[model samples]
Target chain A: MSEPQILIIRSVSFQQLDQNLPKLQEAFPGARIALLTHAHGVRQAEKYRAIHRVLAYPFKEGFHYRRRAADMKREQFDAVVIPVTNLSGTGFFNVLLFSLTIPSKRRFVCNMVSDIWEVSASRIIWMGVRHLLFQAVSSILSLLLGIFAVLFLPFGLKRLSKNK
Target chain B: MSAPLVSIVMLCWNRIEDVRESLNRIREQHYPHIETIVVDNGSTDGTVEMIQSEFPGVRLIRMYKNMGIEAYNIGFANARGEYTVIIDDDSFPAPNAIRRMVDKFEADERLGVVAFDVRNFYSYDDIKKEAETTDTVTNAPAANDYFMSFNGAGAGVRTSVLRQIGGYPEEFFLYNNELDSAFRIWDAGYKIQSFPDVVAYHKYSPKNRTSWRAPFYYTRNAFWTAWKNYPADMALRITIQLIYSCLYYSMEQRTTVYLKAMWSAFRDRGRLKGKRKPVERTIAEQLRVPWNVNFTFYR
Candidate 1:
């Protein structure tokens, strides 16, 4: 139980962190736990003194991911934990990115309803597919709406000018 | 040790010439500890090569595709400075703008954002005309430290403070992202104010953009902001107010664009639900709820 260090790559909101921190702390009472969360989580991280370190990790952009990965390599960790309940596309990317970026012996993705399980290659592939599918659908919807907006724009502008 | 470095971050789309001119303006600034970082969102107009060849000292992060307003997050990640000045491609800050904004932040530790007096560079008449026509609500002019939202084009933010509140709402995609981020900043116990003396001139072009998309984003994001930042009751009230305004514009202009905006907002209600984090009453009061009803920005 007396592990040296642990990292939690949090891609979730501050609220989720507030809910899950105690459980995490209880599970790893001996290890020094560090958190990688968004900038907004910094103030919130203040209350949880159990967590040894907090780094404001930008979870959205890939370029930042690379930068953070480089900065994170300075310290070695025994384990990395990811909460899966509030995971989004960016969150998934962060998990994949950090997994590659940081070297660790054990990696776990946890959820409230289930037990902690190690992330596998197939699981990452599945999440990636889901993320891509969602993105493709979103882009298609935007394109349709954009074309619709443009089609009706000429008449709208013309009428507005007439009214003015 | 030395003075805190300021990273002037310009989010450029395809305007290569404007980007070059804006860099020249940055070079003209009297400030000493400054670095220029341009986040070009997938521009095919030779913007990458131009910046690499000409502005060798400038740090450039090029995306393969246009990622909209969220592209600035890349610049924020790479920015090595105490303060990050957000700039638009066509917006030009005065020589002393950076010095003044940094000084303001130095004076007030709680100041999260400092918005510049963004005057339309075209003409006074054009400003007046914009005021009359646009449905967007511009910030009412104030004497000093007026509680208002940040203007993405010419606002200086403490880099540390920005990370605390998370960066700009990448979900906003395009317009109104500044206000969305500002609300979060306010909720984080930071002050966002207008520094009237610090000025930036915005070209506010009419031809370079597709004017049709402006109304759509304005309507949708205004409603989205109301929902995401307000309590349930106030959120509902503001949502209704926005719908009414959109309908009013739709009826007046005889265009479906406003309706499309309303529809888009309504359709995205579930997405809005996920992002909602109601601010404290104090912060919510500063939001100026009713003002966002017909809120329009000069594009």
Candidate 2:
């Protein structure tokens, strides 16, 4: 029921990081988000102050990936979403110091790369539907608990006071 | 001259520099017979002055205010060519792109359109991968392949086909107007094919991308485009894609717009119908084939 800090990493330059960020922000208000981008796209991150951080890296000779890993390690995000397509290959790996790991959510676009969690716009949507149902059920239980407290609690409190 | 090799209808708004660059390419064409017209969609960016001075020899049609994207239809109505080619001013076809596409029409009278491989400047890498190969829209007939794919940035269509199925819709100001046109051509017994070798590069601008209008019309028009063709299970396909889209994009604001677009398309279904020949493309009744594309609403 709480907002999760969504860490997003795509191969796109830093400039377009904010394009999808605002859409995410509108979906989850005040949600903490940090982008893992390349050095070229840093200006895009500056466009929004609400961005917790923008991690940039040099894209040659594997330097860019190291920066990406480092950003993930520093942020320690709740969950990550990568907007991948069949044409793309960027996928899961939670950030950590000295050691690399897989993301909490290992999803990518299906019909793209195989042997990985397939992610698509469809999955993002159904997850929201499931979330609403869970919240709705929990709300009903909270309501029942409030009713029980009101109906029988006055007599119970009075009896406890006399015993004391 | 020979009914003009191809009539060029350029739909433009504002960006004069981009169009001027494209017009330069058009002026250098090897084919001599041609008529080019620029339809100004009520741009306030001094596009009229630029077109007049820079593209002096070309004809110009100026609208008082933005008449939506259907303004191209006005230019099309006035076209005086046997074959009409619609290209956005931002995108430039190769010198021989028109000649190659026009050749296809001459090769086959029934060929309604020869849709060239419309490439964007950003997608050069993607195009380079297949530069060595030769590709055609469909080497076969329309009945053999079915009319499913189209891109309007660079393509030569028969003027007769335009009359047969009616021309482009005035409503879909930007996105997928070609797609809508493609289906109508197929339903009316004509064909639109993609010729891979006949390439047209879109020259995507760094400052201006087509996406500012994407979230609005792209999301909404996708389903509406399908609805215009598919009679049976359009609703189910749209609903499935809607859920599918949410999975990929985790933003409620974008999702809300997508849902609203579908709702609006349904409410305004009256506006879409009767504009062209009714086509049968719903998912339930669809005949799945190797080349037959599943036109799911992907915004």
Candidate 3:
């Protein structure tokens, strides 16, 4: 396969940015590497030699965040790498979203110990369907719980008042 | 007078090496009058045995099953120190960190928690390097502003305040327990602050770290924390916003963890019934992320 024209690395902490960036460069030779990270990490990310560009994800601004995602999609990255600690990739919802959004054919997830896997589009779709179903079911149950909470509100308030 | 007794409470689940390292660091603290407590969340590994044999002085609370963050409650109950330092198995304070944290608490009567600057490292060597190079005394101004919550990895809590708030919300099980406790602390008229000079190192090990559990627990506990602490109108508003956020993230991340967490939260709503003693509206407003900017994005 031909080398990617541009590559993006998305992470929450960007903890292994320094170590992972060079290895990624060797794998995707000549690819322009960009760092996509939380805004707080922008200054630290900028200091790295391997990162050709830095894109800070605005944590609080929904509209601006959407605009930033759209801008990234326009860049049309050839590959996206998400470094995760484990197979479940639990705290990486934002990273997963970015990888899917940027229109990258080669989406890779790696762990700190260097286990990397390519996530296929079909697999992504399957995961979405499965989890979305779970979410739907959970939402209904949660609504019921909310009703229960409302019912019990009086007692809770009484307890609070007693403590006061 | 001797330094007021500081209790170091750490939770371990099968990570024996990390726990051992943390305990050794605790033993090396520059501050005198410190007690260490280890709550083993039913480790199949030799964690319980090791703590018993190697660190007999440590107050070890052994459990038969992993109770997650709820296990900390047992440790807190047994804590004899005036201040309790809560940390994970893979985290520990700098030698002088406990001393500095105590100073902060003594300086401000309203201060309930003094958060440590938790530095994460992938390797033990790196942690050692950090310890060697870190400045124990600094003239640099620390951030004096009050924060909403403290990092669970490495933060100190006033034992009395912790007890007053009834420890952590046992219903939380794991994630977001810090925030739940923080809310109660704030409502009790105490402040939480982070000091850069007080440092701790987290191993940040990738091993045995579950992927779906964090998202699930975080999502579920977010609801509980809001419902249990926030004012009704504010809670409802935050819940609606959270639902939208979760829905968006679920579709985007292609994981049902968030939805499942929500469902579980709903299923367990009975636990929170009558548990709602909302914090003041002002406290809720100050602590909450503005709804408009709460949406997170990655470029």
Candidate 4:
């Protein structure tokens, strides 16, 4: 009704944010907007100089994230925007925040493919796929690291014993 | 004494039309001391605006994003009513539904939650046929002392008890959340009943819509619920059956979401130890007692 408080979550990259920012601003002209960019994109977002405030996602930083959430719970936003074109690792964090944060009335999942700002069910499906893919890849990597540590543990222990 | 205020908590997302219809139905109810709280899960279809402009009396809590079941926690925090009735956006209750549920609560102070007889709005003919068959062939129990869960769309929870157990578990982002709450209620020595006469109409639209995340949450939350509430032996057995069924469903649907869901559940198993408060073995057995075949929507 009045000036809407818009929160845009674009975690893909500064390039992606740059590409989408113009249209988003154009879509809601008088709205007071705040930006939550991925840590990697914070530098780019800070330089944009358009949004009222720019904040970096705490990501795996547990304590800071809780503080952020507590601070956010104090304020009410009119709309929350998720600009998703393709899935990236950072995009998953955006999705997690989307699941964690509570917005007022409007949630727009802006998909570049369809050039639409409406909530797309397909986008949810894609997010799940991307999330699992990340999980599978990370799990494999951890397993490999575990095997590497086991293979070298005996030699390192023997060397320590000899030195003693 | 004046009638206690009943707070109707509706968790809504982007189904603007359905939510409007549901709110209208609530307004049509005969209940006098009632308040409606709409927790909008970041709906982009002007749902908040519509509610503000049309139903000015309704309290609206807006979430910038969709927090799924966690929206209930947000609504519960602001709820000042003695009794809290949670209904889904796509569902609406019968005119007398609220009064009947409250009557049950009044009849028994120990009653914690009343699970309404939720019927499919679109399947009236089939439900009627099934009801007629059951009525003639069987003498089924009108109310179950131990309910598996309360339908989030059509259940009334005692506000004081809700606050005691710390509201709905926000960990359950979407699915099987009610079971978690139901178990805690039972553990707190409160009774949960399925009132057959108290009815609400659920459209059950998600069954037709394909969302891997829906099944994913169901599979994941099923195991999570068991781990958090059931005793060691019962939890193990139920989790095993759930995993097997999930595997079967995944194979049948040709989707890997179930496998992923299981992996996610097990990966997050570390948090269970601190949250676990296993119910009594006898109580767990009573809760699992299968009464008869009943059809639940796939969603």
Give per-residue CA lDDT, model 3, range B1-299, as digits (tens). 77799999998999999898989988888888888989999999899999999999998998889998889999999999999999999989978888888888888899899877666545323322232345643413233222357779999999999999989888888778888898888999998876756778787645545666666777788878877888777676667657766776666556667778878976777787556788888788666332321222211
User: Candidate 2 docking category?
Assistant: incorrect
What is the per-residue lDDT of model 2 for residues A73-157, given as tens digits with 9 covering 90 to 100?
Answer: 4455555555422222211111111112324433332112222234544454555475466446535554554354345433323
Candidate 4 structure quality by residue, lDDT tens digits, A3-112: 88888876332334545666777787888888875343343344444578876655422212233543566667777777653322222333534534544456675543
Better of 2 and 3 by DockQ: 3
Against the true structure, whose lDDT is highest?
A: 3
Q: Name every residue pair that clashes in candidate 3.
A: A60-B293, A90-B211, A138-B263, A142-B266
* Residue B113 miss distance in model 2 (angstroms): 1.1
lDDT of 2 by residue, B1-299 (tens): 26355788888888787888888888877667788988988888888898898879888999988776688888888788888888886877777677777777888887888776565544343313332234432233222222344666777788878866667877776676776777777776676665555667676433454323554566556655654555424433443444334233323223355445545654565565444233654322332211101111122
Residue B155 Cα positional deviation in candidate 2, in Å, after optimal superposition: 1.6
Query: Every model's Cα RMSD, please?
Result: 23.2, 17.7, 6.6, 21.2
TM-score of candidate 4 against the unseen true structure: 0.59
TM score of chain A per candidate: 0.64, 0.43, 0.75, 0.58
Query: Any idea what lDDT model 3 has?
Result: 0.70
- Candidate ranking (lDDT, best to worst): 3, 1, 4, 2
Alpha carbon lDDT of each predicted model: 0.66, 0.55, 0.70, 0.65
Candidate scoring better on DockQ of 1 and 2: 2
Interface RMSD of each: 21.3, 23.9, 7.9, 23.1
- Native contacts present in candidate 3, fraction: 0.04
Worst 10 residues of 4 chain B by lDDT: B290-299
Clashes found in each candidate (C-alpha, N, C closer than 3 A): 8, 19, 4, 11
